[model samples]
Structures are given as C-alpha cells and as structure tokens.
Target chain A: MNFKNFITHTLLLLLLALIQIIFLKNLALFGVAFCFLYLLGILNLPIPISHVPLILLSFGLGLAVDVFYDTIGIHAASASLMGFLRPYWLKAISPTGGYDDSAKPNLPEMGIGWYISYSLPMIFAFSLVFFTADQWGTGGFFGVLNKSILSSIFTVVLAIIVQLLFFKRRREIR
Target chain B: MLRILQFLYSLRSFLLFVLLEVLAIGLIVSNNSPQGAAFFNSSNAVIGTVLKTRSDILDFFSFAQANETLILENALLLEQIKALKQEPDSLPIPLDSAFEAQFQFTGARVISNSLRFAQNHLTLNKGSKDGIKPGMGIFNQDGIVGRVKSVSENYAVAISLLNTGLLVSSKIKSTENFGSVNWDGINSKQAKMLYVPRHVKAQAGDTIVTSGYNAVFPEGIRIGVISVVNPASDPNYLDILIDLSTDFSRVNYVYLVENTQIVELDSLHKKSEVVNEF
Candidate 1:
C-alpha cells in the first residue's frame, strides 16, 4: 500500500474503533444481539495484503477493542482467527475473472453479492469465536450459537450500512 | 534444511494464529483468577475517566430527577432531627457522631451501573483518596445498594445487590424471623429471601431489614418488603420474593458506610470461639 492509502486506512481503523467503543458498545438489541461495526476495518482491507500482516493487524484491532470492552483477550483472539481465514475466503469465492490488484474488497468495488458472500462468513467466524470465548463456562453450545448468529446478523447489517454511507465508488472509464 | 525451512514458512500463518490465541486465552485465564486487593477488572484510570465523562453527560439530562431525590432525602433527614429533639433526656448528636467512632460515611457518585448481567457491578467516583475502602457497605436514602469490592486511587467498584453472588443477612420486621436475601438473576426489581421457616407468618407487605448479624452493614437498614411467599420444595423453608426498596436504575449518589466496630467485634467473636473450644 502507498503511504497515502496506509495513512487513510489507519485513520479509518481508529475512527471505526472509537465508534465501536464509545457508541455501539452499549447498543444491544433484545439484550442478545450486538453490533460490531469495528470489524468493518478488517473486512474492508485491500485483497492483496498477505496473511502475516493481516493476522497481526487483526490481533492489534481486537486488542484495541478488548481494552475498551474490559474483556481481556476475547476480541483479539477472534479477530486473529478472522484474519487467518480471509485469504482462503477470497480464493474460494473468486469470480469468473480474477480480482484486479488495484481493486479493494468493499461494496463499491465489489457488487452486493460478492461482498455478502465474502464478508458474512468472516463476520460469522469472528462472532462465533468472540461469543464463545465471552460466554465460556457460563453458557451452553445452543446459547453460544444463538448469540453468534443473532450478533452476526446485527453486525453485518450495520457494517453494510456503514459501507454504503462512507465507501465511495470510483467512476468507470468508457 | 531447505525442506524444513519451506515447511516452516508454509506453516508460519498457522503458527502465528496458534501463538496469538494462546496469548489471548492466557490473558483471559489470568484475569479471571482470584487476585489480591488490586481492582484488576474495571477500575483502571483510563476506563474510569472515559466512563465518568459519559456518566457526567448523562447525569446532566437527569438533573431534575436527581434534584427531586435529594429534596426528598433532605426532608426525611429533617424529620428524623425533629423526632430526635422531641425525646426527653437524649441530647441531639450529629448523625455521624451518633454512630461509634469507628464508622465514617463517604459520599460517592455512581459513574457506571449495570443491571442486565447475572453479576452486575457499579463504579463509584470516590476511591482510596476519599477513604473508600473495600468491604464498606453502600446505601442510598431508600435502601442498601452493595458493598465495595475493590478500589483504585480515585475510583471504587462495588458489587451491586443485583449480583447473584451477594447475600444480605435480613429479617422480617414484624416477626423478626431471620433469613438471607439474594438475587435470583430473574428480575431486576425483585430478590429472593431464603432460609425463612415455612411456619413463619410472612405477609405480602412485611418489611425486610438487615439483621446486622454480618459486620458489613449496621442493624435495621431497610432492604426490601415481602412480595410473594410460597412453600419451598424442600418443605423446610419458604420461597419469598422481595420488592427491593432502592431503585438501582435511578441510584446516582450513595453513602459508603465504614463500620468502626467490626474489627473489635470480630476479635471478640474469635476469642469466644477459642474459649468454647477449650
């Protein structure tokens, strides 16, 4: 990534993390589902980034989140897992023509179908690990599953809305 | 060596993943373990300051409600003063002076509170600097809140009565039948009273007050009122519900009560135990 893009990504990550901690941390629906908009930073990373940096970034992001939530390491663990699986997910869902090096994996760069297919599994994986670690020894498997599914849905909806609001599309050349 | 290097390189991502997960789990385990008096959970300065700022903004919106509560408490205090003056020979002493020299009350503001968790906790703005120590009992004008769990320099975390782990030694006001009150984790507005014999005539409106058997709280602090009574399945006790007096959702200001005589009483009890053993 160029220095300009690197700076932009860092600023975006900070903004998303702040919003998650300050505002969305308290926003729970029915006391079960929670919105984790901070995952948008991880999900929207450029597709060409390698696995090591991606996983490290995920860990850092999760740790930042954990500091605010007062949860020691649960978010970091889950974010690392999500980062580890992102490359495989991109490879598995590659379109008829391969992804362009310049393309970013966002709503504007990729259509709704590709974005959902790519992001949903990553969000679900992250949520499953997160809620499982959070409710460990206190709740049963069914409870974990229910929380993960509901939270994933809430998180994905919020993430999509955020993308639509902030992620601008590049104009196509004739 | 080349093959081994290739293998290691190929598995580097997986290794990193495992290493990070182990570190995270290690942190979780260490955090959950019982540690000394250091309030490791939520009393950190940064988190406390952030929460305090948020609470301050929210407190601004609830100014009117808070004012009403303060006015009511002031009126009650005045009435108590008037009643005390009516007595024949008793000299009027300051409220704090009336208690033994060992007890002190530190005023604290509740900066963060939670009711939804099975184990809920409240963060207060006063801490060690304000003489707020762990084991100090907290109460609002209406009733008992909880005891201090841990304290940082300027912040203290109290385990709220809504938490499942807290049990207040209590008795019915009319019959003086002793029991313990605990949260059943079902309702925020209600708690369960345990160990009361089934034969005790506990009515729906009977009041429950602290028995002062535990050194944590003084005698006769109001806890709640009996709301429901049913025979326990064990056939030895009654399953009673209490309508909690202190509306925890609205509790902002609280008094942290430090019992001065607890150490003396505890030592005396220990001595008596030794004598009995002999």
Candidate 2:
C-alpha cells in the first residue's frame, strides 16, 4: 500500500477501535448479539495484503481491544484466526474477472452479493471462536452457537451500514 | 537443509498463526485462574486513562441519578449513626480487642464495565495509589458488585459477580443455609446459589447475603433474592437462582471494602491447609 493509504488505514483502525471501546463495549442486542465492529478494520484491508502482516495487524488490534474489555486474550486469538483464514476465503470467493489490484473487500467496493458471500462466513467463524473461548467449560453448545450466529448477523448488518455510510467507493478513492 | 528451509519459509504464516494462538491461549489460561495476577487488562495506565475519560463524559448524563442515590445513601448512613449514638451522660467503656474494625471502606468510580461476555469484568478508576488492592470486596447500596482482581498504580480491574469463574460465599437470610453464589453464564440479572441442600427451604423473594465465611466480604452485605428454587439434575444440590440486587448494567460508583487482617486470615488458612476461595 502507498504511504497515504497506510496512514488512512491506521487512522481508520484507530477510529474503529475507539468506537468499539467507548460505545460498543457493553452493547449486546437482546443480551446475546455483540457487535465486534473493529473487525471491519481487518476485514477491509486491500486484497493484495500478505498473510503475515494481516495476521499481525489483526492480533495487535484485537489485543488493543482486549486490554479495554478485560478479556485479555480472547479477542486477539479469535481475530488472529479470522485474519489467518481471510486470504484463503478471498481466493475461494473471487469473482470471474478476479479482484482489481487495489480492491478492498468491503461492501461499497465489492457489491452486496459478493460482500455477503465473502464476509458472512468469515464473521461467523470469528464469532464462533470468540464465544467458544468465552463459554469454555460453561456447557451449552447451543447457547454458544445461538450467540455466534446472531452476533455474526448483527455485526454484518452493522458493518454494512457503517461501510455504506462512510467508506468511499473504490473509484472515488483511487 | 535448503529444501527444509524453503518448506519452513512457505509455512511461515501458518507457523506464526500457531505461535500467536498459543501465546494468546497461554494468556487466557493464566488470566482465567482467579488467583493469578493479570498482566494485560484495563488496569494498565494508558487504558485506564482512556476508559476513565470515556466514563467521565458518559457519567455527566447520569449525574442527577447518581446524586439522588448518593443522597439516599447519606440519609441511610445518618440514620444508622443516630441509632448508634451514645447518650451524652453515658459512661465511656474501653472496647475489647474483638471490637476493632476489621474492614476499611473506600469509594471508587466504575470507569469501564462489560456484561455481555460470560466472564465479565469492570475497571475502577481508583487503584493501589488510592488504597485499592486485589481481593478487596466491591459493593454499592443496592447490592454486591464484585471483588478487585488486579490493581495498577491508578486503576484496578474487578471480576464482576456475573463472571462464571467468580463464586461469592453467601447464604439465605431467612433459612440461614449458606452456599456459594455463582454465575451460570446464562444471564446477567441472575446467578445460581450452589451446594444448597435439596432439603433446605429456599424460596422466591428470600434475601441472600454475604456469609463472611470467605473472609473477602464482611457478613450481611446483600447479594440478591432467591427467585427460583428447583431440584437440580444432580439431586444432591438445589438449583436455586437469585435475582442479583446490583444492577450491573448501570453500576457507576461503588464502595470497596478491604479486610485489614486478610493477610493474617490467609496465613491461618494456610496453616490449616485450607484454600482461600473468593
């Protein structure tokens, strides 16, 4: 990425982290669906980004959030898993013409159908890992799965709303 | 050797992922144990400052409610003082050593808190600098909140009573049957009272209070009211649920109580080969 793009991404990551810590910390929809909106910072990175940096970035961002949430390593572990899987998921779902060199896997740039197909399962995987770690030895697989599914759906809806409202279209940004 | 190096280089991302995941899991395991000191949490200086600033802004909107609660508490304390006041003509008697104060209380602001997670925690603005220490009991006028888990220079992190790992020693006020209050990880407003015998007459609306058995909290601090009493699958213990008195969602200011003689008590327990459960 260019220096300007790197600066913008870092700022965006900071903004998302702030929102997650300040506003979304205690928010749970109907006491189950939690919004891990900061995942968007990792999810929307340029497609050409290498796996190593992506995993490191995800781990760092998650740790920053974990420090605030007091779930010390839970978020970091889950976000790292999500980051590690992103490249494979992106390759599997790449469209016929394939992604542009500068493509970002976000709703505004990737269109709704492709974005849903790409982001939903990744988010589901993230929520699954998060709730699994959280509910470890607590028993009730159904409860974990219920929370995971609802949280992923809730987070995706919120993520889409945020991207639609704020993120610039690829053409406009370029 | 070059071919093996090439293969290792090819699997670098996977190896890094495994390394980081192992590191994170290690942190989780180390931090999950209630007695282990937490290394990374809101108790850190920078995170504490950030959480405090956020709370400061949000608390502004709730000032009137907080003021009303504080006034109510003040009135209650004044009434208690009036009841305890000695008559002016009464002769002063030297108190026995048994009458010495065992617990000291301090006030703190809840800067950051979370309830959605199964293992929830809260961050208090006061820390070791303010006489806050790990294992101090936290409560409000409404009910018990939690115990301090770890403390930094200017902040402390507390495991909320809603955390599945925290078990508060408690008893039914009516029946006098004591048990451990444990969060079942299913709900925030309710917690399970474990080890209550199946024959104990626990009922809905019965009050639960700290038993003083654990030594972390003084006796008689309210915990909650038993809302459900059922025969558990274990058949030996009762499945009793208590509606937690502390409204954790809006918990702002809290009173922390530190036992001055906890070190002595802990050492005594150690002498007897008993584990300290808090």
Candidate 3:
C-alpha cells in the first residue's frame, strides 16, 4: 500500500479501538451495557486489502480486546467471521463492480443508504457470533440464542451511526 | 527453490495476517477457561491510563453533584446523631444478639464504578492496606449497594447486586419474608427478590430490608420497597420485585462497613458448618 493509504488505515484502526475502549465500553443504556463495536475497522477497510489479511487484522484486534474484557475466543472468532464475510456482503450490496476503483470505501463511493445496508448484516453477524460464544454455556442454548439476537440488534444500531459519521465522504472516486 | 521464493514473496502479506490472527486467537482461547487469565484487561498501562483519563473527563460533570450529595449526607448524619442524643427511640434499633456481632460500618468513596452492564462492579478508595477486606458490606444513605470482592493497596472492588453471581440475603420487614435481591440486568430502577415465601402478605410500599442472615449487611437496613410480588406454582417461593431506595446508577460515594470482629464470628459460624457437614 502507498504510505498515505497505509497511514490512513493504521490511524483509523487505532482511532476506532481508542473510541471503543474510551467511550463505548463505559456506556450503560437501560440496564444492559453495550458491547464494543470496534470491529468496524475491519469492515471499513479499503477493498484493495486482501480478504485473509483483513480477517486476520480484525481477529487480532478482537482477540486483544478479549484479553482485557476477560471473555474467551468468541470475539476473535466473530471478528474473523466479519472479515471472511465482507467480500460476500460487498458483492451482495454493491451493484456490479459498484465501487470506485481508486478510492477507499466511504460515503461518496457508496451512498449513505448503500453503506448502511452493507454494514448492517456484517456487524449483525459478528455481534451474534461474539455474544453467542461468550454466553454459550452460561445461559444454555436458548441463552446463547437470546444474547446473540439481542446484542446484534444493539450492535448494529451503534455500528451504523459510526459508519455515517466517520467513514468520511471522498470528494471524487479516484 | 525458485517456487519457494516466489510463494514467500507473493503471499507475504497473507502470511503475516494469518500469523497475527493466530496469535490473537491463541490468547482468546487461553482466556476462555476458568483459570484463563484476563488478556485485554484495562489494567494494562496503555489502556488503563487512556481509560482513566477518559472516565475522569466524562464524570467531571457528575463529580460536582456527588460532592453535593456527600455534603448533604454528612448534614443528615449529623442531624440524626443530634436526634439520637435527644430521643433514643429515633436511633436505628440496637442490634439483637444474633446480629450484634454481624455488622460494622466504615466510610469509603467511589474510586471507580461500572454501571453499564448486566453485571457491574464498583471500586472504592479503601482496600486491604486500609484494613478493608473482601466480602465486607458496602452501603450508602438510602440502602445497600453491594459487598466487597477484591482488594489492593488503597482500593477495593465490590460485586454490586447488579451482578448475577451475587446473592445477598435480605428480608421484608413487615411480613418477615426473606429472599435474595437481584438486578434484572435490564433495569437500573429495580431489582428482583427471590425465595420469599408465597404465604406471606406482601404489598406495594411494604419495606424490604437486609435479613443479616448472611452476616454481611446488618438486619433492617432498607433494601427497597416491594413493587410487585409474583409466585411460582411449583415452588414455595415468591418473586418480589423492588424499586431500590438508592439510585444505583448514581452511586458515587459510599460507606464500606467493616465488621471488626469478623474473624471471631466467621470461626464460630464455620465450626457450626463443620459439625453439620458430618
């Protein structure tokens, strides 16, 4: 990757992690505390980033957080799943080669509507995997099911907002 | 040899990603077990300092209100002491023998608190070094908050009733019904009290207090008011939901009550347990 692109990705990745740790982890709404939604870093990666590398990057970040969070391998697994599924999602949501060739995925390349649609399913799936794996035996099978669904809904709502605000709008698709 | 060099050169990025993921997954798997140590714990220097700074900034607004609350509580406590001097009847009832050795009070302030979860923990400004030990009762002006869990120098953590693992023994005053109060993990305004006998008459506004059976919190310390009572047909217990007297979401400062004579009482209790075990 070019230096500019490389720096941008690294900075954004760290920034997302910083925001997740500093703000989101501490947020308590209703009685249920929200989960960290930092996996958007993997999802927002430029299409040029190879799928395996993207997945690995997300897995690494998620695993690091898992250590601090005291949860098991669930986050790593879920983040990897998000990385693996990103290509399929881009294909499903984008209209045939429907991306700017030389630009990163942002609001300008993918309309706000398209971007939201693209991120929702990816985030929802990752959230389900993460919550289900953690709450697995703790809540029984049904408990896992309950946590997966409940947390996905919450995670998606928050993730979409992150995309809209920070996935910056490129002036012109290169 | 040529193909090997080509493979390494062409797939280097992919290999690096795989290696990175492998390391992360390894850590996650390790932490899953019961003895699995905390991996991403915020106690790390980089995360801790950043989190601490941010937590302080967000709470700065409330620190002022917390200060006011502490001042108001001090005033109220002073007034109660004055009233106690003039009229002994107004004092919290002198403990009956069973409870005489169970409860003690020590003052503490919230060094850090977590409320945004299904289970929450609070850290106090006192710890083992300050003679504060785990399992001690933590309370505030309105009522019970939680019990101590872990302690370090000058700081201790309490597993708040919001935690599912916590089961504090409590009783309803008027009916003498006893139960364990729990947070729904869904509501800060309320908690669930279980094991209350269905036969007892429980009504809205009836007082629920700590039973002191656990020897952690003293008996008759206000827990909450019974908001609803639901009974299960298969069991003899009733579900008692309480609107907690204290807004747990807003607890900033608290009193860490240390039962000075815990060692003596615990030994006696264990002796009885050992006999029963046989």
**Top of the candidates by TM-score:** 2
Using DockQ as the measure, which candidate wins?
Answer: 2
- Provide per-model DockQ scores: 0.46, 0.86, 0.33
Candidate 2 ranges beyond 4 A from true positions? A172-174, B276-278
What CAPRI grade goes to candidate 1? acceptable
Q: Candidate 1: interface RMSD in Å?
A: 3.1
True contacts kept of each: 0.48, 0.84, 0.36
Q: B102-167 in candidate 2: lDDT tens per residue?
A: 999999999998888889999999989988888899999999999999999999999999899999
lDDT of 3: 0.68
lDDT of 1 by residue, B37-82 (tens): 4324567788789878978988898989888989998999999899
- lDDT head-to-head 1 vs 3, winner: 1
The best-first sequence of candidates by TM-score reads: 2, 1, 3
* Residue pairs of candidate 3 with colliding backbone atoms: A67-B39, A67-B40, A68-B39, A68-B40, A68-B41, B106-B257
Error of 3 at A6 (Å): 2.6
Better of 1 and 3 by TM-score: 1
Best by lDDT: 2
Each candidate structure's TM-score, on Cα atoms with residue i matched to residue i, is: 0.81, 0.97, 0.75
What is the C-alpha local distance difference test score of each model? Answer: 0.83, 0.92, 0.68
Listed per model, the TM-scores of chain A against the true chain A are 0.96, 0.96, 0.83
The residue-by-residue lDDT of candidate 3 on A75-162, one tens digit each, is 6777877787787677777667676677555555666677668776777787667655544343455644555556656766676676
